[model samples]
Target: MTFEHYLALFIAMFLVAVIPGPAVFAITSASIARGLKQGVNMTVGLLLADYLFILLAISGLAVVAEVLGSAFVIIKYLCAAYLIWMGISLLRAKPGTSITEPKMQSTQSAVLSGFLLTLSNPKAIVFYVALFPTFVAIENMTYPDILGIMACATLAFGSVNLAYVYLGSQARKLLTTPRRLTLLNRCAGSVLAASGVTVAVR
Candidate 1:
């Protein structure tokens, strides 16, 4: 792909990344409950996951996509259910409830959770499967070109997500109040669940 093509793809991916989803909600909640460090860790986990998927998509692994696609409907519903459940749990968190700050998980756990969280969403899989071809010219592209594009995309996503995490951490002070925290949790949770539902329906 030309630089211009890559730029366009980056912009499109950025927009997609900005949309609220389970991952965003999870990161934001972690930030609010823990701190910026945990939030950033979550973002890094997500970036690692994105890189893995991008590599798979680039390598022409249609088998994975095909297998996942076959169960997309089931997976979508399960994800939707998980989101809604998480939202309700957040909504029900008691005021003055002290949540233990999350310690950094093992590297393997972080990467695995990140990959599974991202890969579980059939929408994301299908999206990369379909969108990757538009930006990457497989026949002519060298490995460096593919790696560069993936790295750029990962950086863009990580930067945006980190910003969100910082924002959430900054807002943590306001969330100290039990009522406020509950409300924020509910709002985030609801948004996540709704996104999942929308994905399932679509």
Candidate 2:
């Protein structure tokens, strides 16, 4: 890909990443509830899912995805259930005698949670499938072109998610008391739950 092509791809990905969606909600909540490490872990998982979708699109599996409409719907519901369950779990968590309560989630668990969330978002798959063809000349696309696009995606997505992690971690610092922590937890949980409901109903 040329420098201009790379720049355009980066711009597009950045525009999309800056929009808070289910994946962003999950990552920020995990960061607020846990810490920077979990947030980064989740970001890695999400990046992996993006790469997978990109591969699928490049390999002409987007048509397959579009054909399996019911499968996507099932994935959406599964994602909604998981989000609601996670939100409730956060709601039930009691603040310990500390500014930041250490979470029980392992690194592997965080990674898996992120992977599932990203994989379940059918819209993301569809977006890439449609978006790529507009900028990428599929008939004459090269390996380097694909690599550049993937690199752009990683940089844009990671940059935005890490920004969210920093914000959430900063918010955690302000949550010095149990009361504030509880309130933050409830608010974040509600947003997540609501996002899930919106996804399901839409």
Estimate every model's Cα lDDT from 0 to 1: 0.66, 0.76
Tens-digit per-residue lDDT, 44-91, candidate 2 = 888888888777777775787878878767877877886787677777
TM-score of each: 0.74, 0.87
Report the Cα lDDT for candidate 1.
0.66
Candidate 2 minimal-lDDT segment of 10 residues: 96-105
Model 1 pairs whose backbones collide? none
Taking all chains together, the TM-score of candidate 1 against the true structure is 0.74
Q: Which candidate is the best by TM-score?
A: 2
RMSD of 1: 3.6
Residue 27 local lDDT, model 2: 82
Best by lDDT: 2
